[model samples]
Target: MKRLKTLASAVVAGTLALALAACGGNGATTETTDEGSSTAEAATGSTYKIGVLQLTEHAALDASNEGFVAALDDAGIDYEIDQQNAQNDQSACQTIASKLVNDGDDLILTIGTPAAQAVASATSDIPIIGTAITDFAESGLVADNEAPGGNVTGSSDLTPVADQIDLLQQLVPDAKTVGLLYCTAESNSEVQIAMAEEALDEAGIAHERYTVSSSNEIQQVVESMVGKVDAVYAPTDNTIAAGMATVSMVANENDLPVIVGCDTMVEDGGLASYSINYYDLGYKAGEMAVEILTEGADPAEMPIEYLAAEDCQLIANQATADEVGIDISGLEDAEIV
Candidate 1:
């Protein structure tokens, strides 16, 4: 980890130097404004410089960012932000994480499992608050969720797997087999899968697991599962969330109902989900950051937090249900997206 951090620092330093050099000559000059102030006045007198590294572009991840920023604003916390999206590239995430560490931000906010992992690898001293991540221990982000013995602690978006499995069963009572789709590279996904498998086993439901290494293979792999399973179960898998349109296209063509891990996934054409509101989850993480930044709370001793069961929402796509010939009328309590 130390060697990797050293390499990341070198890469980011070179990249930042080239970036600065490219913008060196812009023919700009500073001048006094009508208010007797320099033209170089900042937008705000922010005392804090917060660095945000988002793993990829997707609805749930985007909501997490929105909520985090909104929370800071609501708290009247003055901050300068340097936010960057990795576009689902691990190397890009590493570069951004290293750059943030080198820039010496007051605190770092990482979205998604990979981004958190990248930031955790970059610095051990800088405080990190991660959102939209599941199973921090499984991802090796900390020694344990309770009493995380390191400079990391944040809210988890771990949907109750057994409850989600029960929802899957309720949605498709006749399903003899379910397809579990996720990214094989994500430890977060693996953690959820293990829990789901246990639930399926106890319920006597047969399931076939499928893995994808990247978004490029999602459509092909999903197409391959066409005739094999009655329905699909996708945990808050980032790769699948980024490629929901493709998954929807294939599943809809075959009239398969897909139960996902979050409300955004349902909005993106998934059949239904019993999951947490990612925006709320992110808000909680932002509050945690405030505690660390303002109250001088030690992240090394802060136990990881989670949303209550009542906080987990039931969201369903009514149009997808109609297209897939599933009866969601029984789920009247669920929020129709």
Candidate 2:
């Protein structure tokens, strides 16, 4: 009877152990299923959201956004674009960036320096790409120009300032003193100014720096430099670019030749400009974004790139040139639009 009781007790213990083992196995299987389900949800092919924070409404920046969207569409990436224009307001830009981060955007595209800086401060995980920025280093995006060892990488719209100075020399050979006019707050303007100053030093040309902090002060500063310098050089500064009409009027009235950092300024009545096509730079940025999205590439690993454009065109406005009493007949290949 005692032996029977012992056997029964052994059987009961063995059954309970089996039951516990079964429960453990079931729990493991369920946990694995839940994890798999979570992963599946994470990998689900859903629409990606991209936030574009543009500083202002300008032709170049607008074109950049257009190019970026076109490239994403070409890649068949279903994405929703949320565009916000800061209108050159830094605080507004910060708000827009914060909202985009809080809203969980997969990527962020910044058009200008302030916008880029705002986005960088807002999030570290979301990939940020910038276009139309002159110098990434000057803009505080990276430590140096060679490698942007961070979460930001994009194209720079840096016009070759040395070549531009050489072009100016070709256009006005007798020009001894050149006036450099730009906005002090714009880092892009500073980058161009630094390059121009160095090139002028190399060329043995004397230059006067006239910087204005806003568009309202442009006309006065430029007017002051009119007769003091033989020629003027204006960079791709948003403030000055927006107020080109005033600069052109003053320059034409004083019969002073003006060389600009961008072809768009040339179109706006400046004498000549040599710079990369803004649209091409935008397209390159778009390409970089695609690489990051598709190839699992990190923005930090991508090197900052500059668009290569050859042959600076001598764009002479006939009316402006005639007004300035400057005549050049040697070059038929020059664009006189």
Candidate 3:
């Protein structure tokens, strides 16, 4: 009878061991999907595969990517990171997203709205974190902002749009018609454009909209409207940001001051911008990622993050101001770049 009891105890211990192995020893569970893809919960203390997809190669986006990686490094998490840039091409972003998903990344970080949307569409099983997106709902990435209610959540680069419009008015107070330049393809840009329109209309400022389909058309579009409007207002549009050289060239030639949405564009030649720090936004996103991956927090319940009001800065480019013959000296409290 004693021998029989010992055998039964051994059998029970073996079953318990199997159950623990199935749980991955860290409350993680794995299963194979119908598509033959393996999906598993993140297990702490194990090396994780992280994939980063950036929409373009602009300074703001680059700073965002840098901050994300820096935060990850600071967290001391063991992760294999694969970073890729789409060069402002949507198709390239799609391909990169698929490759990253197929690579079986534990998590994916997207820099812009396009990249985020691509990755979100590629795989619903993988967690996605996006930064530099203005409105997740407007971008169709999330159904609600307070609670993501889906597998997507991240930081927003939603600078104070109305305040930016007000700053543009302050810079060019005598301006009657402010030319609104942006790309129609980006929904993020569209959200900003609508806000700018409402703000401009509220100020009784007449505005003209100039649309660009791609980077190649920016110069011609800006040239056509340079002399027609008193000043140009560009929201945080990635296509226009990438082609700021041409936009600034046309604006400078016509002595038309340009008010942009971010400091990076100001540095690229726009006269001024009231914006949030993209790097800070990215760093915040990274911290959220660590919580989700290491702490096993669900991203679906994570609230969308934003840069604090204190972190927003006013950036003015002295060279651009001087070239455009705008006197920014009277502007008090602005950070001269």
Clashing pairs in 2: none
Candidate 2 residue-wise lDDT at 278: 72
lDDT (tens digit, per residue) of candidate 2 on 1-337: 0001111221122211110000000000000000112222246655667788877765667777777766765666556678787777667777788988998988888888778888999998899999988767656787655678888988877666766777778778899999999877776776677777877998999998998876778889988997799999997777777678889999989999898877667777788766556777778888888777765788877877776545334455667777887774544556776
Extract clashing residue pairs from model 3. Answer: none
Instruction: Evaluate all candidate structures by whole-model CA lDDT and list the values in order.
Output: 0.77, 0.72, 0.78
Which of the two candidates, 1 or 2, achieves a greater lDDT against the reference?
Answer: 1
The order of the candidates by lDDT, greatest first, is 3, 1, 2
* Lowest summed lDDT window (length 10), candidate 1: 17-26
Q: Is candidate 2 or candidate 3 better by TM-score?
A: 3
Q: Kindly list the per-residue Cα lDDT of model 1 for residues 1-337, writing each as its tens digit.
A: 0001111221122211110000000111111111111112234433677888888888999888888877776666666778788878777777788889999988999888778888998999999998887766666787867778998888888776677778888889998998999888777777677777777888899999998888888999999999999999998888889899899989988998898988888999999888788888888888888778766899988877777776777788989999999989888578987
Give candidate 3 regions above 4 Å deviation.
1-44
List the candidate 2 regions with Cα displacement exceeding 4 Å.
1-44, 311-314
Score candidate 2 by lDDT.
0.72
**Candidates 1 and 3, the one with greater lDDT:** 3
RMSD of each: 11.1, 23.4, 17.2
Range of the 10 consecutive residues with the lowest summed lDDT in candidate 3: 17-26
| Candidate 1, residue 335: lDDT | 91
